[model samples]
Target: MRSMLLRARRLLGALLLAALLAPAGAMAGPCGPYTTGNIPDCEPQQQAPVPYGILETQGWAYYCTGDHPYFWGLSSSYPGDFTWDNSCFSAIENVFPETTPNKFDATFTNWCLSAENIVVTLGCSSQPPPGFGPSCNETGGPVGDPGCPQSNISNHCSSTNPPVCFQTATETCSDGTTYSCTADQGIVWCYKCG
Candidate 1:
């Protein structure tokens, strides 16, 4: 029988090559509990949607990290419009640096997103991306908590209020831990991820 149909076509090609070589942490990321992937230890996040009357008026959130990145400093200095108004920024690698509504799905509260936006800033170009200790700005300023509080309606934002912003509380920063914050003008607000 043609060697039993070539041994059942080599046992169905070794079970589809063992299910495509499994083990990317078993392709974790039904995204549940923010189950990251993409094997960079940066884990895979992926989110995209940033436009709402221009949140905090351009020029990114200036968070920081991505290791040494040449010791930072490249903000055209108080020069607004780093683009986002034209919208289109999610490169999708480690996306859940929290612009809004990740953790796999929580009603995507726009303007990047929130209600516990997991602060990243690992490449530190801007937009909540700084790095290298003190957990890098401890989730981004105004004594951050990044877990989104102040009665999280995605922590209420406002540049002209799409969902309205500013909840600003839960202090104890300067490395004392204790997070959950707000404030965009009183200085880049942030904390809370783990």
Candidate 2:
């Protein structure tokens, strides 16, 4: 009778061990049926597109004492022609002189590009802060600042399947000045200021 109890206990332990280990083994098995050589015939992994946009930094210039700077502008992205406009001004609390006397810096965070193109423009107002003139060359152009008066900027994909994405844009002012900006993996990689 004692031997029978021992056998039953051993069987129960073996069953429990198998129960605990079965799920792990199943998880380790090939995703699909194995080939004749026992190699996994798995399907190729599909890569999903990561949606993103471009962010432009504009409006960094020298400021006069007690003279707050303002940034007012419009930004747009193409392949879909989405647009955004904003106005930002410096208050006594936020405006301060930089280490270089009479110099202040500000940025324009507008527009994003998921796929194709991005266009950003600064200096929309006629009375922009001193030292903050229209950087783009705008000859014979419209009266007021026509935000980034350049042509269409393009972002090309490297591959179709699991495509590598890049975002870029060029700002050409009326004065024949140029600035280039690029984005990779949802972050601005380089922004060449005029």
Candidate 3:
């Protein structure tokens, strides 16, 4: 009888230790209420288009001060759902997605987290996201462009999207100008290094 009792005690202790040492993701469920200074227990994750546009993106405590950091813009075209964690203080609303779609995300499908009158964006990984690249170069012209005229957006070596993510603005133009100190809007060919 004493031996049996001792064995049971040992088993219980081992089980408790195993539970404590298990991986964080093993239990499953949200580790949210994720806020500016709160790091939830779950692992950071970004998964999208799993079962067809089933977007899911979550991140723990990360200090961000810019609007862009909170603004999770879709990959130019893929859009879906209005989801937020508990910290956001907003409910999970579908917001009539099937009928209406808009260019600006704030209205219908922008993942915004708000706490204390502050709103931040958090985008989900899209349906497989985009592959390859999409670098934004000088959109030369399309015949009837509303005119993105010389609005201080000069021909500078820009840190554009994919295709040419990082740029080295070292071009000795025909007019004798090197680096990003040029002051003209002439046409020059941009070689893409992927």
Candidate 4:
């Protein structure tokens, strides 16, 4: 009887071990879209798209703060490469709406000058835009002020009372939830997560 009891104990330990290991697979899946925040080993995306376009290919909207020093020059000079579709130039323009609401006229209208121009514009930033510097917190120009129209928000902005900036416009999340920006002036706020 003692011998049988020992065998039973060994069987119970094996069952427990299997149970512990079995659920690891399910846990990884239930996590559903792991972020770098949770997984320390995960690497940052090798190809970080510069924020541009009405809808990022990865399904994100972008905003900008006129901080890109050479953005205007690049956009004006490099017509083929600079525009709303490029992600780097688009980063500020894409994130604008979260704070200022309805600020990106170009995005509101769903304008796409050409897919090729948009592609060229991505990953091409020699200088920062006018308002933004190295940091998002640094306030440029007047306080309580809106900077230039982001490519995404330009069209609708000119028609507003204060000559509103388009990047300032806000948008609802894909989940249909509403969230406000932390601040209005310096940083361009992105509403959704990729």
Candidate 5:
């Protein structure tokens, strides 16, 4: 009789475990406080048509500035239910640059691509800042006023000796002409490389 009871207990435990591991929505009901459409206002707003062109650029610039309160408010409206086209993030992907191995990443899709040895950082630091390259160039805005237009470019030289070239930062030459500079990540840019 004790053996039978032990066997029954084991079966019950196994069944309970299986049920718990199943998908949370298997029951499919109003699931207490959070119903299907009952989302809070703080969620990112579902972006319409994914702002493209300069509007997209401006949106990304705004998102980059964490100080904006609307950032979180706008994000809260995103539908938590599923991951769709993700048109909302297109601006960010387009404005910034992306790199690939043996291939040039012309369009910006995501940040920090290790294959191309490219990493974009926030604020002026040892690494290239977010808007350091054509992103800033296309926008035609001063990189920043932090004592200098902090920028750099790093890129594969495709030659011997200096297989990798980098430039920290530079200023305009005495002749009032700007020069080109390279950064540590092999990103090539112009900024009076004197």
Candidate 6:
């Protein structure tokens, strides 16, 4: 009886091993269409292209006390690689001295290609306000104020956009063999006439 039990156990182990290994060979078939020469001619799958063009804006706020106008100096986190264009896209006065005495607040916008850290400096000079010297303050960083509006690039190549139409052409190679090619806005593919 013990010998019979050992034989049965060995048979079950062999059956399980065979079952596991059998599917591996069955799965090894041609994954795509083949040409007349039995060569695989798998068409490359297309992927969603990344949008390289980007337009974004950085926000800033400042407060100055004096009768003189204040000017802003902007700098980027990446100095030479990425820098502000030295011009503010937009500016608005949030607080005025008429409403609040000796206190003022204004917001400014600067444009950048990608997301970057922006630093703003305020400089002011006053002539009439003798006792009250020009005092300037800056408040901004990589990420600007939470209450301010931020800008971003819109996706123009998404599925919602129109499909790209490809142009087909035929060209002869150096050996005088003609090949068919297709090109879209930025990509071109050529295949031999087999």
Best by lDDT: 2
Give the number of the best model, judged by TM-score: 1
Clashes of each: 35, 11, 1, 48, 23, 0
Model 3 per-residue lDDT at 133:
18
Candidate 2 displacement at residue 139 in angstroms: 23
Clashes of 4: 48
lDDT comparing candidate 1 with the true structure: 0.30
lDDT, residue 74, candidate 4? 22
Instruction: State the number of backbone clashes in model 6.
Output: 0
TM-score of each: 0.23, 0.21, 0.21, 0.18, 0.18, 0.20
TM-score pick, better of 5 and 6: 6
lDDT of each: 0.30, 0.32, 0.27, 0.30, 0.29, 0.30
> Which clashing pairs does model 3 show?
70-121
- For model 2, residues 1-194, the per-residue Cα lDDT tens digits are 99999999999999999987543223222221222221111222212222223454344332221111122211110010111122221111113322221222333343543232222221111122234333433233112222464444555443235544444455666776555434345543222343
Better of 2 and 6 by TM-score: 2
- Could you give candidate 6's per-residue lDDT for residues 146-182 as a string of tens digits? 2222122111111213422224344455565444333
For candidate 6, the C-alpha RMSD (Å) to the true structure equals: 30.8
| Cα lDDT for residue 5, candidate 5 | 100
- For candidate 4, the 10 contiguous residues with the lowest summed lDDT are 37-46
Residue runs of model 2 more than 4 Å from their true location after superposition:
1-152, 174-176, 189-194
Model 2: worst 10 consecutive residues (lDDT sum): 73-82
Model 2: residue 34 alpha-carbon error in angstroms? 46
